[model samples]
Target: MNKLRIGIFLGITAFAIGFAACSKSDSSANKPDPTENGFDKTAMLTNYADNLIIPAYTNLQTQLGVFETAVNSFMATPTFANQQALKTVFKDTYLKFEHVSVNQFGPAEAALYTNFTNTFPTDSAAIEGNITRGTYNLTANSTIGQQGFPALDYVLFSPFHLNDFSGPNAANRKKYVQDLVARLKTLTGNVLTGWQNTYRASFIGNTRSDSGSPIAFLINQFAFEMDQLKGPRIGWPFGKQSAGTMFPNNSEGFNAGISVALATENLVSLKAMFNGNGSGKGMSDYLIALKKDKLSSDVMTQFDKAINALKAVPDPYATAMSVNKTQIEAAYREIQILLTLIKTDVASATGVRITYQDTDGD
Candidate 1:
């Protein structure tokens, strides 16, 4: 009878052990997956869509409307007051363009919107050809250099060509300005409407970092703009391109003498996008989510340094290029540091591949 009791007791102990093991297994199964525990991709995308991207496009559209009105007023009167007002409006619109230019995806990319609106260092010969012909196609790739804000700059501010707006060619020049502004207004309007009506939903829905994801596209565009800031806007004019030979004429806003101002605006827009301007989550928050606190801080600090350096550069950037080249180079170096941080550290931490090619070697 004692032996029988011992067998029963052993069986009970074995049952208890099995039951405990099964309980532990169930608890583990009920726990949340590590990948999904902290990250909320939907929230991030929603914030970007609702806060940063839409508002930027809206502001650009509004500014372009004002610009078009100013152009129309100037064309009607062609007086000094009207011309100055038009120039002021043009500057304002161009500054607004800087904010949205970094967003090179969706409708903007499909429309080649940047090329249509702000391609720089205007082709003087091509612009003259278009004006002389008066029958050229602004939509053609061939006219990209002749149809953007830079072309307007030529007609409005070129010292020798100031006559282009007030002399024998004035009629042709005015027509060209009117046409360019009209096209710019339409294109910008379309992009803004697209985001509001359709693309915003798709952009927010794409939360993955796959090839065509919004995050990937944003990163790619951000990188491309950084290269633009470093190379064409600053370096090319500073002579960092063209084998260390200074090309003051290549400066953006060369005719308007607002190159530094334009660069400052571009830098500010970049920083705003990076930080989301405190309105919502941005790339900085994404980096933090990836546990890249140091990288996030580093990138923000470098951007501040670059911006400060740019602010210190003298305005009338064409003049500064000749007399204060050192300051320009200083700003260029700071931007280069930022380029490395974003291209390497941020890209790696976020798993974003840098798809933009740096052709200038600066």
Candidate 2:
């Protein structure tokens, strides 16, 4: 070959090799890390611990402090005005309880916090026996229904059934109320202390999505609480899940007639946790990162629908259950939809194995 032709061929070959090398380098640099492509489990856990869980428990603890004072005042006087003030504080504390109840792991699980704080459809007979005897153990599993918010609901609002707390049992009733509130205060303090002092670090640091990790426990508890909201809180009372038998008294806050209000607060808290409350990292963000946008949107939409439905039902949920059964049913349906999305789509996308037992066949 001529020198000029050889020089041109050599130049073209070198340029081609250099271009290929540059392209390969760019591709390597642009490739996403496998870990990054997977979920940032740490970010989600940190956001949850800081933004949702800690704040929720702290708020509950603060409210319970106020509630305890109110209880003490009411117990000292036991007048109608004092009773009204105590009821107001009790309702406030109960609403706050709704916000933190879904966090059923860490110290909460150890304390059986939910079972201790809000077991509903309280066994009136058991509660009465405890009050009459004045020697019952609050921590015993059999006393679950006789010592939580539900028991307070009975003593505070439905005292009329127990002879309006004006008969011989009045002092016993008051004592029982005091004991329940005091126990709640102590249990809540333990939970708050655990989170603030010890569990917070471990919760945020353990970022795996496996069964034993904080993330899995959170997801499972979240779903379990949603089921609680749908089934026992709404459906069972509406006769939709209890073989078409209306049992309005079975509702949460049934005596105080604020079941819908408490349910609304619970739903609000759940949505906040789902969205991470603008923390820039939540279950919704994690799902979206996993390309489960549809699932995330549907879950959020269902939450809004449920909240709106509950809002439509007037206050005094006991009366509303009879007069506004349709609205309550609608809210229950929306919650069920949300539960399905969380258990199936969100769980599948995130590889979170739900450890809670599902008996509702949903």
Which 10-residue span in candidate 2 carries the lowest summed lDDT?
A: 1-10
Q: Tell me model 1's lDDT, rounded to 2 decimals.
A: 0.74
Best by TM-score: 1
Q: Candidate 2 regions off by >4 Å?
A: 1-39, 159-166
Q: Assess candidate 2 and give its TM-score to the true structure.
A: 0.86
**Per-residue lDDT for 118-154 in model 2, tens only?**
7777778777787787778898866766778888897
| TM value for model 1 | 0.87
Cα error, residue 351 of model 1, in Å, equals 0.7
TM-score of every model versus the real structure: 0.87, 0.86
Question: Model 1, which residues run further than 4 Å from truth?
Answer: 1-37, 79-82
**lDDT agreement with native, every candidate:** 0.74, 0.74
In candidate 1, residue 106 scores what lDDT? 74
Model 2 lDDT, full chain set: 0.74
